[model samples]
Target: MGEQRKVLVTGASRGIGRAICNRLHADGYAVVGIARTRPADLPEGMDFHCADLSSAEDLRGLLKKLAAQGPYHGLVNNVGLVQSDPLADVLLEDLHRAVALNLEAAILCAQALIGGMREAGFGRIVNISSRAALGKQSRTIYSATKAGVIGMTRTWALEFAAQGVTVNAVAPGPIATEFFWDANPDRDATTAKLLAAIPVGRIGEPDDVANAVAYLLDRRTGFVTGQTHFVCGGMTVGAA
Candidate 1:
Protein backbone atom coordinates (compact mmCIF):
# COMPACT_ATOMS: atom_id res chain seq x y z
CA MET A 1 0.00 0.00 0.00
CA GLY A 2 0.97 3.69 -0.28
CA GLU A 3 0.55 6.59 2.12
CA GLN A 4 -3.03 6.97 3.29
CA ARG A 5 -4.97 9.88 1.86
CA LYS A 6 -5.73 12.63 4.37
CA VAL A 7 -9.23 13.89 5.26
CA LEU A 8 -10.36 16.69 7.55
CA VAL A 9 -13.69 16.27 9.31
CA THR A 10 -15.44 18.97 11.31
CA GLY A 11 -17.75 18.44 14.32
CA ALA A 12 -16.24 15.00 14.55
CA SER A 13 -16.35 14.23 18.26
CA ARG A 14 -19.57 12.17 18.08
CA GLY A 15 -22.69 11.21 16.23
CA ILE A 16 -22.65 11.25 12.42
CA GLY A 17 -19.39 13.14 12.27
CA ARG A 18 -17.59 10.57 14.39
CA ALA A 19 -19.05 7.78 12.29
CA ILE A 20 -17.79 9.48 9.14
CA CYS A 21 -14.34 9.73 10.65
CA ASN A 22 -14.35 6.02 11.42
CA ARG A 23 -15.69 5.04 8.04
CA LEU A 24 -13.18 7.15 6.13
CA HIS A 25 -10.27 5.97 8.23
CA ALA A 26 -11.36 2.37 7.70
CA ASP A 27 -11.28 3.11 3.99
CA GLY A 28 -7.57 4.03 4.35
CA TYR A 29 -7.81 7.78 4.83
CA ALA A 30 -5.71 9.55 7.42
CA VAL A 31 -8.56 11.13 9.36
CA VAL A 32 -8.19 14.33 11.33
CA GLY A 33 -11.31 15.15 13.32
CA ILE A 34 -12.02 18.62 14.65
CA ALA A 35 -14.56 19.38 17.34
CA ARG A 36 -15.05 21.57 20.39
CA THR A 37 -14.60 18.67 22.80
CA ARG A 38 -12.08 15.90 22.37
CA PRO A 39 -13.48 12.40 22.56
CA ALA A 40 -12.16 10.37 25.48
CA ASP A 41 -12.64 7.19 23.47
CA LEU A 42 -11.11 8.33 20.23
CA PRO A 43 -11.45 5.90 17.39
CA GLU A 44 -8.43 4.02 16.10
CA GLY A 45 -6.52 5.43 13.10
CA MET A 46 -7.86 8.92 13.64
CA ASP A 47 -6.39 12.12 15.08
CA PHE A 48 -8.39 14.73 17.00
CA HIS A 49 -8.14 18.50 17.00
CA CYS A 50 -10.17 20.57 19.46
CA ALA A 51 -11.38 23.93 18.24
CA ASP A 52 -14.49 26.08 18.34
CA LEU A 53 -15.50 25.90 14.69
CA SER A 54 -18.20 28.47 15.12
CA SER A 55 -15.59 31.06 15.96
CA ALA A 56 -14.22 32.62 12.78
CA GLU A 57 -10.91 33.49 14.37
CA ASP A 58 -10.50 30.04 15.84
CA LEU A 59 -11.31 28.38 12.53
CA ARG A 60 -8.82 30.62 10.74
CA GLY A 61 -6.16 29.76 13.28
CA LEU A 62 -6.86 26.07 12.91
CA LEU A 63 -6.62 26.37 9.15
CA LYS A 64 -3.30 28.18 9.42
CA LYS A 65 -1.93 25.47 11.65
CA LEU A 66 -3.13 22.75 9.31
CA ALA A 67 -1.67 24.63 6.37
CA ALA A 68 1.71 24.74 7.99
CA GLN A 69 1.51 21.06 8.77
CA GLY A 70 0.41 19.63 5.40
CA PRO A 71 -2.28 19.49 2.78
CA TYR A 72 -5.71 17.86 3.29
CA HIS A 73 -7.24 16.48 0.12
CA GLY A 74 -10.61 15.54 1.53
CA LEU A 75 -12.93 17.67 3.66
CA VAL A 76 -16.18 16.87 5.44
CA ASN A 77 -18.10 19.95 6.49
CA ASN A 78 -20.09 18.24 9.24
CA VAL A 79 -20.37 21.17 11.64
CA GLY A 80 -23.85 22.68 12.00
CA LEU A 81 -26.21 24.46 14.37
CA VAL A 82 -29.79 23.34 14.83
CA GLN A 83 -32.21 25.79 16.36
CA SER A 84 -35.88 25.07 17.04
CA ASP A 85 -37.98 28.18 16.72
CA PRO A 86 -41.16 28.92 14.86
CA LEU A 87 -40.89 31.43 12.05
CA ALA A 88 -42.83 34.01 13.97
CA ASP A 89 -40.67 33.60 17.05
CA VAL A 90 -37.29 33.27 15.37
CA LEU A 91 -34.56 35.51 16.70
CA LEU A 92 -31.95 37.24 14.58
CA GLU A 93 -29.24 36.12 16.96
CA ASP A 94 -30.25 32.50 16.48
CA LEU A 95 -30.30 32.91 12.73
CA HIS A 96 -26.87 34.53 12.79
CA ARG A 97 -25.45 31.75 14.89
CA ALA A 98 -26.90 29.05 12.67
CA VAL A 99 -25.70 30.70 9.48
CA ALA A 100 -22.29 31.39 10.97
CA LEU A 101 -21.62 27.79 11.85
CA ASN A 102 -23.76 25.88 9.37
CA LEU A 103 -23.21 27.92 6.25
CA GLU A 104 -20.38 30.41 6.66
CA ALA A 105 -18.01 28.05 8.36
CA ALA A 106 -18.26 25.50 5.58
CA ILE A 107 -17.51 28.17 3.02
CA LEU A 108 -14.55 29.40 5.00
CA CYS A 109 -13.14 25.93 5.48
CA ALA A 110 -13.48 25.16 1.80
CA GLN A 111 -11.78 28.40 0.89
CA ALA A 112 -8.93 27.64 3.21
CA LEU A 113 -8.47 24.01 2.08
CA ILE A 114 -9.13 24.29 -1.65
CA GLY A 115 -5.66 25.66 -2.33
CA GLY A 116 -3.98 22.53 -1.06
CA MET A 117 -6.48 20.39 -2.95
CA ARG A 118 -5.89 22.40 -6.07
CA GLU A 119 -2.19 21.77 -5.80
CA ALA A 120 -2.87 18.07 -5.34
CA GLY A 121 -5.34 18.18 -8.23
CA PHE A 122 -7.87 16.06 -6.33
CA GLY A 123 -10.43 16.73 -3.61
CA ARG A 124 -13.74 15.70 -2.11
CA ILE A 125 -16.03 17.95 -0.09
CA VAL A 126 -19.01 16.51 1.69
CA ASN A 127 -21.41 18.84 3.41
CA ILE A 128 -23.68 17.40 6.10
CA SER A 129 -27.17 18.63 5.39
CA SER A 130 -30.54 17.59 6.85
CA ARG A 131 -33.98 16.56 5.60
CA ALA A 132 -35.11 19.66 7.43
CA ALA A 133 -33.62 21.55 4.50
CA LEU A 134 -36.72 20.49 2.64
CA GLY A 135 -38.73 22.18 5.37
CA LYS A 136 -39.80 21.36 8.92
CA GLN A 137 -41.93 22.68 11.75
CA SER A 138 -40.05 24.87 14.26
CA ARG A 139 -36.92 24.82 12.08
CA THR A 140 -36.98 28.25 10.51
CA ILE A 141 -33.29 29.09 10.86
CA TYR A 142 -32.12 25.52 10.84
CA SER A 143 -33.86 24.85 7.56
CA ALA A 144 -32.42 27.99 6.04
CA THR A 145 -28.90 27.09 7.06
CA LYS A 146 -29.11 23.53 5.74
CA ALA A 147 -30.69 24.70 2.52
CA GLY A 148 -27.86 27.15 2.17
CA VAL A 149 -25.44 24.26 2.51
CA ILE A 150 -27.05 22.48 -0.42
CA GLY A 151 -26.82 25.59 -2.56
CA MET A 152 -23.16 25.99 -1.77
CA THR A 153 -22.51 22.32 -2.49
CA ARG A 154 -23.88 22.67 -6.00
CA THR A 155 -22.00 25.86 -6.76
CA TRP A 156 -18.73 24.52 -5.44
CA ALA A 157 -19.12 21.31 -7.40
CA LEU A 158 -19.53 23.31 -10.57
CA GLU A 159 -16.61 25.56 -9.80
CA PHE A 160 -14.24 22.71 -9.01
CA ALA A 161 -15.31 20.02 -11.46
CA ALA A 162 -12.65 20.86 -13.98
CA GLN A 163 -9.99 20.68 -11.29
CA GLY A 164 -10.65 17.09 -10.16
CA VAL A 165 -12.73 18.05 -7.13
CA THR A 166 -16.23 16.99 -6.23
CA VAL A 167 -18.65 18.62 -3.82
CA ASN A 168 -21.82 16.95 -2.52
CA ALA A 169 -24.30 17.08 0.32
CA VAL A 170 -25.67 14.29 2.50
CA ALA A 171 -28.99 15.05 4.08
CA PRO A 172 -29.83 12.67 6.89
CA GLY A 173 -33.33 12.06 8.17
CA PRO A 174 -34.38 11.20 11.75
CA ILE A 175 -31.08 9.63 12.73
CA ALA A 176 -30.92 8.17 16.26
CA THR A 177 -28.00 10.22 17.49
CA GLU A 178 -27.53 12.22 20.67
CA PHE A 179 -28.84 15.31 18.92
CA PHE A 180 -32.04 13.49 18.08
CA TRP A 181 -32.57 12.20 21.60
CA ASP A 182 -31.86 15.59 23.13
CA ALA A 183 -34.27 17.27 20.75
CA ASN A 184 -37.00 14.73 21.42
CA PRO A 185 -36.44 13.76 25.01
CA ASP A 186 -40.08 12.91 25.64
CA ARG A 187 -40.37 10.61 22.58
CA ASP A 188 -44.12 11.11 22.76
CA ALA A 189 -46.89 11.49 20.21
CA THR A 190 -44.64 13.58 18.01
CA THR A 191 -42.07 10.83 18.01
CA ALA A 192 -44.70 8.31 17.04
CA LYS A 193 -45.83 10.59 14.25
CA LEU A 194 -42.28 10.83 12.95
CA LEU A 195 -41.80 7.08 13.03
CA ALA A 196 -45.06 6.48 11.23
CA ALA A 197 -43.90 8.67 8.37
CA ILE A 198 -40.59 6.94 7.79
CA PRO A 199 -41.03 4.21 5.19
CA VAL A 200 -38.28 2.14 6.77
CA GLY A 201 -40.23 2.25 10.07
CA ARG A 202 -37.13 3.01 12.13
CA ILE A 203 -34.69 5.77 12.94
CA GLY A 204 -31.56 5.99 10.79
CA GLU A 205 -28.10 5.36 12.15
CA PRO A 206 -25.05 7.60 11.88
CA ASP A 207 -23.32 4.99 9.74
CA ASP A 208 -26.17 5.23 7.24
CA VAL A 209 -25.21 8.81 6.49
CA ALA A 210 -21.54 8.01 6.77
CA ASN A 211 -21.85 5.34 4.09
CA ALA A 212 -23.34 7.84 1.68
CA VAL A 213 -20.49 10.24 2.40
CA ALA A 214 -17.93 7.52 1.92
CA TYR A 215 -19.35 6.86 -1.52
CA LEU A 216 -19.05 10.51 -2.46
CA LEU A 217 -15.48 10.63 -1.22
CA ASP A 218 -14.34 7.56 -3.09
CA ARG A 219 -11.61 8.20 -5.64
CA ARG A 220 -13.60 6.24 -8.23
CA THR A 221 -16.59 8.55 -7.79
CA GLY A 222 -15.00 11.72 -9.06
CA PHE A 223 -17.61 12.16 -11.77
CA VAL A 224 -20.39 12.36 -9.16
CA THR A 225 -20.75 15.87 -7.76
CA GLY A 226 -23.20 18.61 -6.83
CA GLN A 227 -25.71 15.95 -5.78
CA THR A 228 -27.65 15.80 -2.51
CA HIS A 229 -27.86 12.24 -1.24
CA PHE A 230 -30.69 11.77 1.24
CA VAL A 231 -30.09 8.99 3.75
CA CYS A 232 -33.49 9.47 5.28
CA GLY A 233 -34.91 5.96 5.54
CA GLY A 234 -37.23 6.85 2.67
CA MET A 235 -38.62 9.84 4.50
CA THR A 236 -37.76 12.09 1.56
CA VAL A 237 -39.66 9.82 -0.80
CA GLY A 238 -43.10 10.95 0.35
CA ALA A 239 -45.59 8.63 2.09
CA ALA A 240 -43.63 5.57 1.10
Candidate 2:
Protein backbone atom coordinates (compact mmCIF):
# COMPACT_ATOMS: atom_id res chain seq x y z
CA MET A 1 0.00 0.00 0.00
CA GLY A 2 1.14 3.60 -0.56
CA GLU A 3 1.41 6.32 2.06
CA GLN A 4 -1.93 7.68 3.13
CA ARG A 5 -2.96 11.05 1.73
CA LYS A 6 -2.86 13.81 4.37
CA VAL A 7 -5.60 16.43 4.69
CA LEU A 8 -5.60 19.61 6.78
CA VAL A 9 -8.84 20.89 8.32
CA THR A 10 -9.17 24.22 10.11
CA GLY A 11 -11.63 25.04 12.97
CA ALA A 12 -11.54 21.35 13.70
CA SER A 13 -12.11 21.45 17.44
CA ARG A 14 -15.88 21.21 17.17
CA GLY A 15 -19.03 21.22 15.07
CA ILE A 16 -18.79 20.61 11.32
CA GLY A 17 -14.99 20.71 11.43
CA ARG A 18 -14.83 17.85 13.92
CA ALA A 19 -17.21 15.75 11.86
CA ILE A 20 -15.16 16.35 8.71
CA CYS A 21 -11.97 15.32 10.48
CA ASN A 22 -13.50 12.09 11.71
CA ARG A 23 -15.12 11.27 8.39
CA LEU A 24 -11.95 11.88 6.39
CA HIS A 25 -9.90 9.81 8.82
CA ALA A 26 -12.37 6.95 8.56
CA ASP A 27 -12.01 7.17 4.80
CA GLY A 28 -8.26 6.29 5.08
CA TYR A 29 -6.74 9.75 5.01
CA ALA A 30 -4.24 11.13 7.52
CA VAL A 31 -6.13 14.02 9.10
CA VAL A 32 -4.46 17.10 10.54
CA GLY A 33 -6.77 19.40 12.49
CA ILE A 34 -6.25 23.07 13.43
CA ALA A 35 -8.21 25.25 15.83
CA ARG A 36 -7.75 28.01 18.39
CA THR A 37 -7.43 25.40 21.14
CA ARG A 38 -7.15 21.63 21.42
CA PRO A 39 -10.42 19.76 21.71
CA ALA A 40 -10.83 17.38 24.63
CA ASP A 41 -12.65 14.83 22.48
CA LEU A 42 -10.07 14.86 19.67
CA PRO A 43 -9.87 11.44 18.05
CA GLU A 44 -6.74 9.35 18.42
CA GLY A 45 -4.15 9.19 15.59
CA MET A 46 -5.17 12.55 14.20
CA ASP A 47 -2.69 15.46 14.40
CA PHE A 48 -3.92 18.63 16.10
CA HIS A 49 -2.47 22.16 15.86
CA CYS A 50 -3.59 25.06 18.02
CA ALA A 51 -3.47 28.53 16.50
CA ASP A 52 -5.82 31.50 16.32
CA LEU A 53 -6.45 31.70 12.59
CA SER A 54 -7.90 35.19 13.03
CA SER A 55 -4.50 36.53 14.08
CA ALA A 56 -2.21 37.24 11.15
CA GLU A 57 1.01 36.53 13.04
CA ASP A 58 -0.26 33.28 14.52
CA LEU A 59 -1.62 32.11 11.14
CA ARG A 60 1.66 32.94 9.38
CA GLY A 61 3.73 31.03 11.96
CA LEU A 62 1.39 28.05 11.84
CA LEU A 63 1.43 28.05 8.04
CA LYS A 64 5.23 27.98 8.02
CA LYS A 65 5.29 24.97 10.34
CA LEU A 66 2.60 23.21 8.27
CA ALA A 67 4.46 23.88 5.01
CA ALA A 68 7.57 22.33 6.48
CA GLN A 69 5.48 19.26 7.33
CA GLY A 70 4.79 19.16 3.56
CA PRO A 71 2.89 17.45 0.81
CA TYR A 72 -0.63 17.54 2.23
CA HIS A 73 -3.08 16.24 -0.40
CA GLY A 74 -6.20 18.08 0.74
CA LEU A 75 -7.26 21.21 2.66
CA VAL A 76 -10.60 22.17 4.21
CA ASN A 77 -10.89 25.85 5.11
CA ASN A 78 -13.69 25.41 7.67
CA VAL A 79 -12.76 28.14 10.11
CA GLY A 80 -15.12 31.13 10.08
CA LEU A 81 -16.61 33.91 12.19
CA VAL A 82 -20.37 34.51 12.10
CA GLN A 83 -21.37 37.83 13.61
CA SER A 84 -25.08 38.68 13.70
CA ASP A 85 -25.64 42.39 13.55
CA PRO A 86 -28.16 44.56 11.77
CA LEU A 87 -26.67 46.63 8.98
CA ALA A 88 -27.28 49.95 10.72
CA ASP A 89 -25.86 48.64 13.99
CA VAL A 90 -22.94 46.62 12.67
CA LEU A 91 -19.63 47.26 14.42
CA LEU A 92 -16.42 47.76 12.46
CA GLU A 93 -14.60 45.39 14.79
CA ASP A 94 -17.04 42.56 13.99
CA LEU A 95 -16.70 43.15 10.28
CA HIS A 96 -12.90 43.02 10.49
CA ARG A 97 -12.96 39.87 12.60
CA ALA A 98 -15.29 38.12 10.17
CA VAL A 99 -13.17 39.14 7.20
CA ALA A 100 -9.95 38.00 8.83
CA LEU A 101 -11.13 34.55 9.81
CA ASN A 102 -13.72 33.82 7.14
CA LEU A 103 -11.96 35.20 4.08
CA GLU A 104 -8.29 35.88 4.84
CA ALA A 105 -7.52 32.69 6.77
CA ALA A 106 -8.83 30.47 3.98
CA ILE A 107 -6.80 32.34 1.36
CA LEU A 108 -3.59 32.20 3.37
CA CYS A 109 -4.00 28.53 4.26
CA ALA A 110 -4.57 27.63 0.61
CA GLN A 111 -1.58 29.75 -0.44
CA ALA A 112 0.62 28.02 2.13
CA LEU A 113 -0.43 24.51 1.08
CA ILE A 114 -1.12 24.69 -2.66
CA GLY A 115 2.58 24.78 -3.58
CA GLY A 116 3.09 21.30 -2.21
CA MET A 117 -0.05 20.15 -4.01
CA ARG A 118 1.08 21.73 -7.27
CA GLU A 119 4.51 20.11 -7.07
CA ALA A 120 2.85 16.75 -6.48
CA GLY A 121 0.35 17.49 -9.28
CA PHE A 122 -2.68 16.70 -7.13
CA GLY A 123 -4.80 18.56 -4.54
CA ARG A 124 -8.31 19.13 -3.24
CA ILE A 125 -9.50 22.31 -1.49
CA VAL A 126 -12.93 22.70 0.12
CA ASN A 127 -13.97 25.98 1.65
CA ILE A 128 -16.83 26.02 4.18
CA SER A 129 -19.17 28.79 3.21
CA SER A 130 -22.71 29.45 4.51
CA ARG A 131 -26.18 29.58 3.02
CA ALA A 132 -26.27 33.11 4.34
CA ALA A 133 -23.91 34.07 1.55
CA LEU A 134 -26.90 34.24 -0.75
CA GLY A 135 -28.61 36.61 1.73
CA LYS A 136 -29.71 36.50 5.36
CA GLN A 137 -31.04 38.87 7.97
CA SER A 138 -28.56 39.99 10.66
CA ARG A 139 -25.68 38.41 8.75
CA THR A 140 -24.28 41.45 7.03
CA ILE A 141 -20.65 40.64 7.72
CA TYR A 142 -21.07 36.88 7.58
CA SER A 143 -22.79 36.99 4.21
CA ALA A 144 -20.18 39.20 2.61
CA THR A 145 -17.27 37.11 3.87
CA LYS A 146 -18.79 33.81 2.80
CA ALA A 147 -19.63 35.25 -0.61
CA GLY A 148 -15.98 36.24 -0.84
CA VAL A 149 -15.05 32.65 -0.03
CA ILE A 150 -17.05 31.36 -3.02
CA GLY A 151 -15.35 33.94 -5.21
CA MET A 152 -11.93 32.75 -4.06
CA THR A 153 -12.90 29.13 -4.58
CA ARG A 154 -13.87 29.72 -8.18
CA THR A 155 -10.81 31.86 -8.92
CA TRP A 156 -8.45 29.33 -7.34
CA ALA A 157 -10.16 26.54 -9.22
CA LEU A 158 -9.38 28.26 -12.51
CA GLU A 159 -5.78 29.17 -11.65
CA PHE A 160 -4.88 25.72 -10.28
CA ALA A 161 -6.66 23.56 -12.88
CA ALA A 162 -3.51 23.10 -14.93
CA GLN A 163 -1.67 21.78 -11.87
CA GLY A 164 -4.33 19.14 -11.18
CA VAL A 165 -5.82 21.01 -8.21
CA THR A 166 -9.55 21.43 -7.58
CA VAL A 167 -11.28 24.02 -5.40
CA ASN A 168 -14.90 23.91 -4.21
CA ALA A 169 -17.12 25.42 -1.54
CA VAL A 170 -19.65 23.77 0.76
CA ALA A 171 -22.42 26.03 1.96
CA PRO A 172 -24.34 24.59 4.89
CA GLY A 173 -27.69 25.80 6.10
CA PRO A 174 -28.93 25.75 9.75
CA ILE A 175 -26.86 22.94 11.13
CA ALA A 176 -27.60 21.98 14.73
CA THR A 177 -24.19 22.74 16.17
CA GLU A 178 -23.33 24.02 19.63
CA PHE A 179 -23.09 27.55 18.31
CA PHE A 180 -26.53 27.23 16.79
CA TRP A 181 -28.12 26.25 20.09
CA ASP A 182 -26.20 28.96 21.92
CA ALA A 183 -27.52 31.60 19.57
CA ASN A 184 -31.04 30.18 19.59
CA PRO A 185 -31.55 28.56 22.96
CA ASP A 186 -34.20 25.94 23.85
CA ARG A 187 -35.74 25.60 20.41
CA ASP A 188 -37.08 29.12 20.75
CA ALA A 189 -38.94 31.20 18.22
CA THR A 190 -35.82 31.74 16.14
CA THR A 191 -35.09 28.03 16.03
CA ALA A 192 -38.70 27.31 15.19
CA LYS A 193 -38.57 29.77 12.35
CA LEU A 194 -35.36 28.23 11.09
CA LEU A 195 -36.92 24.78 11.15
CA ALA A 196 -40.00 25.96 9.32
CA ALA A 197 -37.91 27.48 6.56
CA ILE A 198 -36.12 24.24 5.75
CA PRO A 199 -37.86 22.20 3.06
CA VAL A 200 -36.40 19.04 4.56
CA GLY A 201 -38.38 19.71 7.74
CA ARG A 202 -35.40 19.12 9.99
CA ILE A 203 -32.28 20.89 11.18
CA GLY A 204 -29.04 19.70 9.57
CA GLU A 205 -26.34 17.79 11.38
CA PRO A 206 -22.60 18.39 11.26
CA ASP A 207 -22.11 15.04 9.58
CA ASP A 208 -24.37 16.17 6.78
CA VAL A 209 -21.85 18.82 5.81
CA ALA A 210 -18.99 16.42 6.50
CA ASN A 211 -20.40 14.02 3.95
CA ALA A 212 -20.31 16.73 1.32
CA VAL A 213 -16.68 17.56 2.10
CA ALA A 214 -15.70 13.91 1.86
CA TYR A 215 -17.21 13.61 -1.61
CA LEU A 216 -15.24 16.63 -2.86
CA LEU A 217 -11.94 15.46 -1.34
CA ASP A 218 -12.08 11.97 -2.75
CA ARG A 219 -9.27 10.98 -5.11
CA ARG A 220 -11.86 10.19 -7.78
CA THR A 221 -13.42 13.66 -7.55
CA GLY A 222 -10.74 15.53 -9.48
CA PHE A 223 -13.20 16.42 -12.21
CA VAL A 224 -15.51 18.29 -9.84
CA THR A 225 -14.27 21.82 -9.16
CA GLY A 226 -15.23 25.49 -9.01
CA GLN A 227 -18.70 24.60 -7.76
CA THR A 228 -20.58 25.44 -4.55
CA HIS A 229 -22.47 22.46 -3.16
CA PHE A 230 -25.28 23.48 -0.83
CA VAL A 231 -25.82 21.08 2.04
CA CYS A 232 -28.66 23.08 3.44
CA GLY A 233 -31.51 20.57 3.85
CA GLY A 234 -33.01 21.96 0.65
CA MET A 235 -33.18 25.41 2.23
CA THR A 236 -31.39 26.80 -0.79
CA VAL A 237 -34.18 25.62 -3.09
CA GLY A 238 -36.36 28.31 -1.58
CA ALA A 239 -33.65 30.82 -0.78
CA ALA A 240 -31.79 30.58 -4.06
Q: Give every collision pair in model 1.
A: none
Residue-pair clashes per candidate = 0, 0
lDDT of the candidates, in the order given? 0.88, 0.90
RMSD to true structure for each model, in Å: 1.7, 1.4
> Distance (Å) between predicted and true CA of 96, model 2?
0.6
TM-score against native, each model: 0.95, 0.96
TM-score of 1: 0.95
lDDT of 1 by residue, 1-240 (tens): 123278889999999999999898888888889999998989765788899898999999888877566667689999888798778999999898888899878988898889878777888999999999999899989889999999999999999998889999999999989888776664578877887888988889999999999999888998899999999989888622
lDDT winner: 2
Q: Candidate 2 overall Cα lDDT vs. reference?
A: 0.90
- C-alpha displacement of 33 in model 2, angstroms? 0.7
Worst 10 residues of 1 by lDDT: 1-10
In candidate 1, how many Å is residue 99 off? 1.0
